[model samples]
Each structure stands twice: as structure tokens, then as C-alpha cells.
Target: MLRFFTRSVLSLIVASASTCPARSSSASRPAFIAAFALSPPSAPSTSCQATMTASVAAESTDLPRWDLSRFGFSSPFSDEIDLHLEETAKLAEAFKAKYEGKLGELSLLSAIQDYEEISKRKTLVSSYLHLSYDVSLDDDTLKKRKGALSQRQSEIYGDNLEWFSLDVAELDDAVLASQYENDPSLTKFKSFIDELRRQKPHNLSKDVERALTVRSPYVGNRPLVSFFDKELSLMRFKLDEDGKEVNMEVLLSRMQSSNDAAFRAKCLQVLNEGLAGSVSRTAALSLSSVAGGWLVENKERKYINLRSRRNLDNNCPDEVVDSLLVGVRSAGIPLCKRFYTLKKGILQKTQGLDKFRWSDRNAPIDIGGVSNEKISWEAAVAMVKKGYNQFSPKMSEMFVSMVEEKRIDVPAANGKKGGAYCAGVIPGVGPFQLLNFDGTKQDVATLAHESGHGVHDILAYEQGYLQYHPPLTLAETASIFGEMIVFRDLLAQSSSKEEELTLLMSKIDDVVNSVVRQCSFDRFEELVHTAREKGELSADELDEYWMSALREYYGKEGDAGGDSPFDSYENTSHLWSYVPHFHHVPFYVYSYAFADLVVGTLYNNFLTNKEGFEGRLLALLSAGGTKDFANALGPFGLDPTSSTFWTEALTAHLGELVNEAEKIAKELGYVE
Candidate 1:
């Protein structure tokens, strides 16, 4: 989970329970991988890179490390810590003593400097051992403190206080914008401040606004909705064919290894049981309530629809988002379903092929294990480097600097989360990544994906902290495009049918998840919010609504009208509980679906029009936090304002997948 737009000392990092940092406010906090949600990859092999497991803590590594001194963090933690309540109280006292209502440039500069110092102290909090304060990622004390700081931050940033001075309003909006012209670093601050001023007329009284800003952390849903997503360390599922114990992740990813329906069902059951476990269910409830509360507030905020606030924050226009959903659901979701039917026919089954298990979607192909062998870590790194280099020599160069310089710390080690992520520390300093690097082909792609994020962060970092992050809707461009690069390169190298099939199927599955699943989540959130506004949503009521949405996206369930016992009470109460977004930001899911197709368009353009394409892409990445989604996309001749813009992008890819899936089915002798 990460924030693209953090404004206070509390909004910095969204670390896990192990290294808990106070997340951003309810309005702006990004959810866990909500920015780049990757479902667990096909289970990895010791030899092949696949999905790695999520574990609890980091182990010591002997690799050469960065100075880390340049970031000004003497310790690993990023801010100052109060080892005890007295110390924290002192911090509160200090702020109140010196910072309550001082409205001068000098006062603001002092606050920023103090925050920078606090960041340095916070990073090394562990280095000093805050063992006595009860510091679980779920630590009660941490929650309390974060709640305090978050509330304070909200009071400041909410419609409560003026983010800028009255002096700003006195200058012409044009010349006022020019006030930060000399320094690019100040431009974003200037803009954000100006935006706040524009809404000054609608703001609560200054005292009320300041009070809201200061007390926001203490409010909202996350506090009441606490759930843990326990990482899997060791898991064994019974394999149907061999009757041998198999790693669930690995076995599920290898569904193509065997044509046994029994095996697929077993994998699904295993996964189902895992999510059905008591702890997971309880967590889901918390997530749902949090999401429900978010819906309530959105109604209060008076946004156009449940999804509109997210669009506004992403700086995306409504039409572009709508277009992406329309094109994908119409073209991509159905194609994915059709491909499943073809697989069923080829595999000698017909009863329930359309009911896809999470496992079978990306099973390793049965091309005699050809072309899908485990790639070495070096090979994965090289592929990513080459892909980035092909795009921009500088971008590629940064990849090397990161890997060789120990800027990256991925090797799929124990205690790291299952997926990959890039954390941009700041400008001048580069970003860091955490990855589970088993040697599967997907692992390599994951590297490319996160590296895409890494590259974007590096370029964006050029804009300094104020402009370093992109809006969520545009954040995935580099990462997904990075994936496209790897996929295209691999496609070029696939000399045989099996490898090509593997590539096509993989692409198809990705399209389904990104376009269909995420958009469905968006729609689901809308329902939850809309329903919650009318009345309080019980767990049963929430489940009923969830299944309704889930069925619509996946397909109507055959057992629905028969009063399935597990439908509400047992099925997916945790749907809302575990994901931090429902608690933090409502309707954040649309960004993924939007960004996925958008990447398709950008990649399509680059593939068809090579000259200056890389340059334009770089320019976009470099604009960072400053550009809205429209402006970020301007140079590429794209606009989210037009429904046609999104449809064209989705059509280009899904149309081909549908055609290829059909051809494959026909060749495999499946009936029309």
C-alpha cells in the first residue's frame, strides 16, 4: 500500500504491521498494491520464477549496500520517534507552542524543515529498538499515535484552513502561478496552494478548517476496521493426479501440466479453504465496514457518483474511465470466458470449464515444458535492463545503477511480501524495490513491471517531492508498459507454438484480471457505498450485495436462487475488511482498469510509431505529481475525456485476443 499524494508528516509511508508507519488520511491513503494490484502469480518453482509467498520480516543480507546517508536517514527508519508517550506529547506540545496559527512564509519553511528532520528519525526507529512501546504493525499504540497525527493532518488539508496565504489571492492567478516559475520544485506547492484558495469561498471557517486538518487522523473508518492478511509461509495441497503433496502456488500455476479437472478443483478448494479460514473471514468483515463507511462519507461529500471522487483525485475525466470499462467488459471479459470454454474442450471436459479457479488461469503450458523453463536471476535482471534500455538508454542505465549499486533489494527472499514494489525515497536519491524473485517466466515479467515503476519513480523524482508522484490512474503506465516490453520481446523470441500459446494465454489472463476484475471491484464499491447511504449495511446485507456484483462480472451463479447457505454468511465478508482502500479511499479500483487499457494504447502507439515515442513517454513520467491524468497523457495524443479514446485502446488488444483464442480453439479441434 502506498500514497501518491501525501501532505503531512503522517502521510509518508504505508508499511505493513511489521514496520508499521502511519498511513495517509482517509481521503488520500493508497491501498495495499491498490496502485498496482498483482494477484499471486503462478506458483514458482525452485528452478523457475513464480509467485513467492508473503512473509513477516526481513532477514539480514550481506550484499553491498548504498550509503543511505545522502537521504539523511542516519538510521533505517525515516522519521523521529518518541520512545514513550512523554516524548510524543512533547512533539505535540512543540507543534502547539510554535505552530498553531503562524501564517508566514518563514513559519511554513520551519515546519517543512522540522518534518524533514522527523523523517530522518522515523526511518531508524527500529535501529534504536522501540521494543517497549508494543510495536506490532497492528500495535495499539502506533494506531493511537497515527490516529492523532492523521486527525491533525486532516484538519489542515481538509476544507478547513487555507493551504496558502491571502497574499496568494492578491496576485493575479496567472502571475501567482508564475511566482514559482523560477524553481520547478515550488511549482507544485504553488498549484496545490492555489487550488485550495479557489475553494476558499466554500471552505469552513478558518478555525474550523484548521481544527479539521489537525484532527482528521482521529476520524474515519480504519480504526474500527482492523484486519490482518496473514502471509502464507508453508502450504501443501493434495495433487489429484500424483496423489502427492504439492506446493499450492506452484501446483495451481501448473494446471496446464495436467489435463485433470479433478486437479483444478482441488487447487480451487485449497485456495477457497484458505480464504474461508476464520482469521481471514474476520478480517474481511472489518474491511467491508470500512468500505461501507467510506461510501457514507462520499455521499456526504456530494460527489457525482461513488466513483467520481476517485476520478477527481486521479485528475482523470469521467468519460475516459467510462470508455475503458465499456470497451473492456464488452470485448475482453467475454473473450476471456470464450477462451476458457476452448480450454475445456481441449482438455476433454465440458461440465464446468467456464467456472475458472484462481489457479488454472495461468497454469504453466504443457508444451513438453519447452520455453517456460526457470530463468536465472541474472537472466531476469538482464531482460529488464535490456527492455528499459531499448526504450530509453538513460532509463536502461538507471536500471543497472540500481541493481549494481544495490539500490534494488529483491531476490524473492523469505519475509518479503509475495509480489514486487518500488518505493521512491526522494529526488536525488533513487527508489528501492522488494520482490519475490523465484525463477519463473512470470517472475521476470514481474521484475519488468516493478522496474517500470522504478524507472518512472526515478524520472519523476527529478521533479522533487512536491511533484514526484503521479495520480493513481496514470501511475501504472510505466509498470504495465514495462510488462508489455517483456511480453513483446518474449513473443519475438518464441519460435514454437507452445511458447506462443503460453504468451497469448498469459496476456489474455492479464487482460481479464485488470480490465474485468478491477472494474468489477469499482462497480462493487459503488453498490456498497450507494446502499450504505440509505441504511446501515449488516454483514449479511453486504454479502448479498457483493455476490450480486461478483456474479455479474464473472457470470450468473447456477446455485443462486436455491438459497445457497454459504452465499452471504460464509462467502466473502472479508471482501471489504482486509483491503485498506475501502477504509482509506473509496473507488480506487477504477484506476487499475483504466490504466491497463491506457497502457495498451500507449504501447500500441510506441509499437506503431517508434520515433520520439520513448522521449514523449519520458517527458510524461518526468512531469510526476504536477500533471493531472489529462495533462500527463497530452503528448501521446490521448485524452481520458473521450470515451472513444479508451475504447480504441481496449479494442486493439481484446479484439486480437478474441481472434487468437478462437483460432487456437479451432486448431485444437474444439467445436464452434
Candidate 2:
């Protein structure tokens, strides 16, 4: 989420987390496979040449890889990267020499402009390296180069520019006011400056800040998270008794897609086993270190609680997050139970299964006329484009440009990162999307989700680099909304009651995943972090916390030992070790739940009042971090601050989805 090894230390400190969920490996295949038409028999020599030519053509049709040259580098190892790094370092030095201790006397506008320029240059290099490192995680040379560059960037920013914020925060209010009045351009950064001022209470001494920044690359969660990712990338799971081992991605994909109940359970077993032992212990150590570091920093900053720092960073109040969590537990949890209860009945009747295991949570149900074939990459792109076009032509055009420009990486490969994410490098440049797409319905939805992030980045470009990134709470709005529109388009295209029911069940699964499941993750983090404060949490202790949270949300009306829909928690307790968010960004899972409900409300508004909704929604995305969650939703007649807002939204949106899916299932005789 922080681009763990690739982004500059300064960017890590200031930038919002990228829109990536927990890491789960899935199946991988060729991006695009060209269909060849048969021809009449011909001469052997001519046919051989023709076949070779056709092979080349098919290879050319493969999904486009990212063109990193756009970042002024031919490759991660290009000389241009070093040149830019040197230039940025020189510029940082000059800027520091000119205005390190004389912030009040110089033109604030000029200083801010110089700072922005330096940040942009550093970010360009960092983003390029991060993207490169993500695809080539197995390349040790690239990994080392990325590490060295990251350390140098950290040194440059820490030694030369760390005092800028401290000095600005220390500036008298009257002085800042005068600068804004005298130079209207300075007003452009008032919000930026005010944000700094808001952190005045937590601002450490300039020397201390510099020390912390310079040492960041060598210490803290970054290095540990990097190690965790590398370990995860290299892990292999046994897929069959023949000893055919696959990467995590393939195993996870099989777990979800395999129709054989025994095989699905086997995939889950291998997945948990692969993540056990050394990997699990390493993950536990890394997580403990992260929580320990966060606790120390929060204590130093005198924040109210563990989550308050992230809440403040998101421009969301603690009470709002509290209300959101409470609502999810009270209303959202019940909705989850009901949905799963219905699903249990459907599986029992349709598949003749006696028990429902965690692997069956995403299992595909057999339905008449529902195709299990993979959607081709090209077709997936067109489907998402049509979905966007249904909402806004402008957005559809932007999505097309992103694909055409080769800014998206669409295939899953060995050593490539497992999850999906969209990284917004800077204001002027479009974001790059990384996905381990295996051509499932979920992958199509993920494509829509990340494209939504890209469009959000494009729409917010006018806000400038400092304000372009939205708060985490609002970041998922466009992505989820994009997913919803595409879902509706898919539903509209369904021709049969069986197909409709299948799609409806899939949508309900996603809703529960995005809302209740994510809230459950948040609860897990809360437990771990809270326990971690007293002492270091052991691997077994982390497992306990995980199972506790799992049962709380996934468990049903009866006790854990009774007739709960889920099987025993043995296979899933270690799953907490693999989620990257828990390591990269603490307490970040709740934002997914928050955004899903928010999008649900806005989506409903769009459905009821089609007129001007596009403009309003685009305006909300365009506002970026400038507007807080509440103010951004003001136009939609929604108030997230109200105690009942989340509960009401959950019932109206997810609850209704469950009801509809259940009705269709019952009508089809799958549920009684």
C-alpha cells in the first residue's frame, strides 16, 4: 500500500495509502489468446513458415505491459534514473541552503513551489522504481537497486528538506496570513499549510525529525514488510498428489473456482500450510514490530488512541469511525449472517453438500446457462468500458485511454505481486494499475475497481500534487461505484433466471466481502494492536486474535461449537499473517467498509435522480483531499456523522441485496 520498497521516505510520510486490499494469490494464464482459423492442407515448408508467423502474431496480441519510459527511464537500471536522482538531490540542497532557516523572510510561494518541484522529481523516480520492483520481485538485482535508491532518496529528503514542515508549522499565524494576502498564489497552499499547522502539537524538533527520516529506510516497518512480500512471492503450494506445486496465486484461484469440494478443501489446506512455519513466524515478527513501532510513535505524538492518528490522517473524526464500526457490528453483522445462512441452504440443496467450509465461501454454484469459461482480457476491457459509459461518457473515454496508453499491467506471473492496486504517481501523470488478473468475474470487478481509482486520479489532477490524493475514507468511493455500475450492466446482460441468480449471488458475496469482512479485519487489527501494547504478541497469540475476530463476524446465532455456517477455524487462523494491509498500514481496513456504504448511498441517489448525478459525483472525486467526507457528501443529502447513518445505509443497501438474492434463490428452488 505504501509501495513498501519503492516510494521515497517523504512520500511514505505524507502520501495516502494506495487502493489495495489484502494479498491473496490466484490463478494465472496468458493475458490474451488469439483464435486461429483452420485452413486446407498446404505444402509442408509453406505451412511451417505460416505457423511461425502466426505464433509471432499471437504473442503480439498478449496484454500490454507497463511502459516505464514515460517516467524518463528506459528501465529500472537506466542511467536516466541516476541522473534524475542526482538532479533532485542538487535541487534539494540548493533549496535548503536558500531557505532552511529564513522561512519568514523569503517568498513563501517560491519556497513552496521549489518544494513541490523537488517532491515531484523524487516521486517520479520512486514511482518508476516501485512499479518495476513490483513486477520483478524475484529479480535480486532490481531489488538491491531499488533499496539503494530508496535509501539515497530518504537521505536527500531527510537531510535537506525535513525542516520545511517544521519551520512552516512554527511560523506565526499573522506571518502566514500576511504572506497569503500579499501573494495570492500562496493561498493555493493554504490548506496544505493549515494541515501542517494542525500537526503542530505533534511536530518534533527539526533535528529529531531529520534523524527519524534518515533512519527510516534501515529501520521500522518498511524493511520488514519488504521481506514479508519477498517471502510471500517465493512461496509455493502443492496443488495435487502428483507433487505439482503452484504459486500462491494459482492455489488461491483454485480454492475459489474448483467445483470439487475435496479439492477446494485441499487447496485451502496447502495455502495455510505454505503460509505456516517460517513464513508465518516471519509475518508475526513483522506485524509485532509494526504495532510496536506505531504504539511508540503514537505515544510520542500524544494521540488519543491507536486509530486516532489514522483517523486524523484521513480527515475523519474518531467518533465517525467509532460510529461506523459500531453500526457494522450491530446491523452489518446480522446482514452477513442472514446472507450466509441463505447461501448455506442454497449450497446444501444445489450441491448436496452436508457442510460449508471457508473455501466454499466463494465457491461457484452450478446454474443453468451460466458459463464457467474465462472472460478474455479484451472482452473484460470492453465490458468495463461499457459499464463506465453507462454512467459517464467522459469516464469511459478516460478508461479507454488508460488501457491504450499501456498504464495497466493485467497478467499474473510468478514473482509478481499477488493483489491489485492503482498507484497515483503525481498530478500530471496518470496512475498505474497492477493486477493479478486470472479472468474470473472477480477479476473483471477488480479491473473496474482499479480503473475507478485511475479515473479518480485523473479527475483530481487539477487539485495539484499536494491535494490530489483523497483521504482513505473517500478513496474507495469511485472504485466501488465503478464496480457497482459494471455489476448492473452485467446483470442487465443476463438472459435467464439462473444467470441472474448467479450474478446476484456473486454481487452479494462482494458486498459482504467489502463491508462485513473488512470490518471483521478491522476488529482483528484492533485486538492485535491493543494486545501488543502491553507486550510482544506471539505467533499463537496473533492466531487467537484472528480466530476471535473471525468468529465474531462469520459465526452465526449458535455458539462457535454449535451449528455455525463456518467449519473449524484451523485452516483460516493463520490467514492474518498474509494480509499486507495489516503490516503496511494499520487500521486501514475500516475504510473499505466505510467507502462501500458511502458508495451504496450515492449509488442509490444516482438510481433515483439520474440528472446531474454524474457532475456531482465527478465533483466529489475532483475535490480530492480538500473536502472531508461529511462535506463531500453534503450535496447527496447524506450525513456520515449521524449515529444511524451507517446502520441505515447497511440495511438499505447490503440488507436489500441479501433479501433480493434470497428471494431469487427461493423462487428457483435452491432455497426453501
Candidate 3:
């Protein structure tokens, strides 16, 4: 049985909620990395890396196990947990023994110190479960465990929250005894928890917390959310494209790279139709979950505004979000619309691509696929190793061990899920990763990206279970940095201008997705959360908000011609269905944008000034969860606090990329 956190046990029981970091940092990208050459009939990865056993169920029996390289040494996860659990049992006994009908003279601070071992156990369990759930959702037992775990978390939080309320009121003593404490070491978390406890009035009773948790998983879950997330995405739609029928994603992929506006528009229409079709069932579950969770928590938690809790969870102040909205609002009217204006001219279209045509949000730059060209996963691993070796041989070898020892799995096949993730394995085995390796150049980069995470996890493995993975804001650092390594290496090896442009554009679009689009989403979430705090928004109202965000983030300012009809209330993946975040964690979206913005500046700094900066970069990666984000980058001289840190990172390549895009537009006689 998994142990829970108690107020007397831990400093601040996050007794935290939910998993899934991808919604913030990971959007489902098509199976682009399954092939590195960026061509069809994708080849298999040549590496003999170990694979994890990720398998779900096909109805009752099971989904096939996704086999990758496996490590020979028994996973250290069990040993770590056993040791921690033993210590925790001892602590629990001591707590019960010492505090049993005790005299009132013991200081509150002293009381907490007595239970440190138990607190550590809870932390260890949490860290372990995070990775366990990531790789594969096994049979019914695993799903039940997840639900049970969430309930247990609520119970723990309710306990600590009680102690938290008392502790925070006169927090100096609590601060002293807290594990994270005045040690500049814990840094942000110290402040983060301070704020959480500061808003103790908003929190509800333990019974209420447990009720919300127990009710949550069933409210809208399982085969349902799984269906939308895992199955719906994989469903193929046939589209008539010049007589031949094509899959919607395939057609859209072409529209992205083909420079054919009409084709792009047609593809988007069909995609919209498909999105529209699935609304009813998905909507029913989605809305019920939200409405139910909202009403219950609203009454129990006593938050002044509905969104206040979520906003607090995001680690962003309301003011910061407002500033971001200002940027988006200002951006929508001019810069974004201007790009569309140019695109409209190129397409010779009236009214521009319809709402459905948003599938072309990020235009793809195709460096023609070399039919016979091949880049092997083994070779890619070697390249990343060499690249990182130039800086930190230890980091390079760590990645090598990850791939060679079968700590990574990349499979390319039909009926497979889209996107990639680095799954930090439970407790001691470090992190394993998931990918669809179809032998594309980008496929190698994906390996590099996830490998960076794997290496990061391995470096921090010695930190023990409870303190391995860093905050979401810092998690993307190593992965993004790893991408820069391969990209810079590839750019150096490129024989011609076209190749460089291809790699450059690919890398730039990555930035656009990570920095620009994610920032846009972060802004949108802020608005919704804040407004909802004030009052409940209708489903249509929610959609309208999304449209407004879309227009602001992706549309040109001058493009709007007075209240264009958008079915804002129409088919939304929203509704209370499965998006475990709202139920679990609130306002977790900004971390990606934050991480990207910071990393972008760091990458640019390395590019312009230091040729041999890879070593320092690896050193940062190797420090892992042992250090907070700010200190991790201290070696690199990048500070994440200032607006300057972000602006410098964000605009680093936009100017050049925009110039080249404009030049290409002019060369094609599309007019600037």
C-alpha cells in the first residue's frame, strides 16, 4: 500500500495532483520523427537500445507491449523504495510513540522535525509514481491505482493543509524546521509553498478534499478520456484529394510543406468536420466533470474567485498573466494578421483560409527528402555523444548508457500514438523515454531531445527518489539543450545552403511552437482561469474565449472586419471530459513557455559567443534535480528572473527567420 503525507509528517504536502506534463510542454505532433529523412516508408532506428514494456489493454486482454532495450541490472527502483519505506515505518512508530498523549510543551517546530522520515517516504512514493504512470497504463489495476493514488494525495494534502494552516500563521519556526527551509538550496519551492499556505483560507476541509478526489476519476474518465486522447487521435479520415483519398493528417502535412493554399484549405475543412463530429459524447463527459468539480469545490474550498486556486497553482501572479495578454492582444491585430495578409495574396483567396484552415498554423519547410539517404539511430546517438563529448564526456557517456542499455524505446507503426515523451522511471531506475523512430533526420533530433531528459534523470538518480525531477519550468531545459547540440552539429555538417535552411527552419519552428504558440496558450489559460474566478463561463463562452485567443495569437490585427462569425460554442475537446489537469493541477501551462524562453536565450548565447560551451551545458544537465533552475544555469550565466532573460531568448532568431521567410516569399513573387 502507498503511504500518504500528513501535516505533521511533511513541511508542505503537495500531496500534489495529477501527472501528464505534455499538455503544457507537449502538444501531439504527427509521427514526424518516426523517420529522420522526413520521408515515407520510414526506416527503423538502427540502435539496439533497451526498450521498456509499455502496454495498455485492447478491450480486455491487452494492447501489445512496446518493447525497447531493457537494462540487465535489476532496476534499482525497488531497493530504493524498500529502504525508504523501512525508514518511514520507523519514523511513523516514533511519531506515534513520542506524541501519544504528550505534554503541550513540545514546540510545533520540534513536532515536525520528529516526522521527517515519514515525510521523505511520501515524497519518495510521489516521485516513483510519476514515472511509473508515464510509460504505460497497464491493465485495470494500474488505472485503479492512479485513481486511488489521487485520493490518497487528497487525504495527505488535507492532513498537511491542517498543519500547514497552523504552521504558516507563525511560519518562522516552521520555516526553520521545514526540509526545504531557509537553505537557499530549495529557493523557489520555499516561496511557492509559502504562497500556497498563505491562501489557506481558500482550501477546504479534508473530507471535502477526499470527496472531490474520490469523485474525480469517475466523473469523466477511463476508456472515455483514453478514447479521446489515445484512440480518437489515431482514427483515420478519408479525404478526396484530386481523386485519390488521403488521410487527413497526411493531407494537412502536405499543405504545410507543399505551398498549395487550396489544398491546405480543403484539408483543414475535412479536419474540422472530423473535430466537429466527435463533440457530442466527448462534450457530455467533459462538461459534467467541470461543472461537478466546479460546484463542489466552489462551495467547499471557499476561494473568493473560481480561478484563484488554479492561478496560484500555476506559480504565476495575476499581473504577469495580464502582461502576457497585453502582448498577445497587441500582437494579434498587426504582426500575425500581416503574415496572413501576405499568405492570402500568395493564395489568391478571398476571405482567406476559413476557420477550419487553422491546421496550417505552423507552415512546414521541406528540404526535399533524399530517397536513398539514411541517418541511423545508432549513428544519431554517436553524433549526439560526440557533440556532448566536446563538452562533458560524462554526460555523453550517460546518454550512451541510456541508449545502449535499452533505457529508451522508439517504435514506428500504425495504430501507434502520436508525440514523444521522456518517462523518468520510478524511483531508482532513472528515466526511460518513448518515441516513434522512423529514421528521419528529425527522428535523430527527437532521440537527442528525449536522450537529454534520460541523461538528466540518470545524473540526478543519485539524489534519491523524492528529489529527482525538477519543476516543469526547468524540466525542458536539458531536452531543449540536447536538441541544440544535434542541430548545431548537423548545421556544421550540412554541405549546402538548402540543408542549412531546412535545419534552421525546423529548429526555428520548434522555437515558435515552444515559445510562441505555448506562450499563446499560457495567455489563454490565464484569461479563462481569472475570468472563471469571477464567474462560471458557459461552454460557448469558453470557446469564444479560445477564439479570441486564437485571433490574438495567430491572426493579424487589421484582419478582423467586425465580429466575424465564429462558432465559439461549437465542438470543443472541452466539456468536463478527460483533461486530468483541471481536476489535478491548475495553471501548469506557463512552465513550457517559461522554460523555452529561458533556453532560447541560453542557446543563442552559446551560438554567438562560445564554440566550446557544450561542456558547461552538460555540467548543468548533470547537476539535475540536485539544484534549482536558477542555480543550474549559474554556470551558464543565464538568469530566468528578468524580463530581459526572456525577451533576449524569445527574439533571438525571430528577426533572421522572419527576414528569410520574407525573402523566400518575395523570390516566389508572392509580394511582400
Give all TM-scores, in the order shown: 0.74, 0.91, 0.67
Summed backbone clashes in each candidate are 42, 2, 34
Error of 2 at 337 (Å): 0.3
lDDT of 3 at 42: 6
Clash pairs of candidate 2?
25-249, 26-249
- Model 1, 1-672: lDDT tens digits are 122221100000111000011122343222211111111111110001112222111233542333344444343222443333225335545654564455332334444344333332322222122111111223455434444433333332332212233233334556544445534455445443443354333333445434443443344343444223222333345645677654433443444333454565565555545545553555445555666655654554555665665565555666666776776667656655665555545443323344434334444345424654567768888988887776678878877877876665444333233333455544555465545444666656666766666777788875545446676766677777777787777777877655676577666656655567556666666677677656656655655666676666666533455321111222233343323344434455555566667888888778788889988988888877677777777888877677576666666776676577668656644546
Off by over 4 Å in 1: 1-24, 28-191, 194-219, 224-226, 230-261, 346-359, 411-418, 534-540, 557-584, 664-672
Q: What is the C-alpha RMSD of each candidate to the true structure, in Å?
A: 7.9, 10.1, 10.2
Task: Please list the C-alpha lDDT of all candidates, in the order they appear.
Answer: 0.49, 0.71, 0.43
Model 3's alpha-carbon lDDT is 0.43
- The digit string of per-residue lDDT tens for model 2 on 259-280 reads 7777877877777777778999
TM-score result, candidate 1: 0.74
Give RMSD (Å) of candidate 3 vs. truth: 10.2
> Judged by TM-score relative to the true structure, which candidate is superior, 1 or 3?
1
Q: Summing lDDT over every window of 10 consecutive residues in candidate 1, give the lowest-scoring window.
A: 8-17
Candidate structures ordered by lDDT, highest first = 2, 1, 3
Q: Sort the candidates on TM-score, descending order.
A: 2, 1, 3
lDDT at 646 for candidate 1? 62
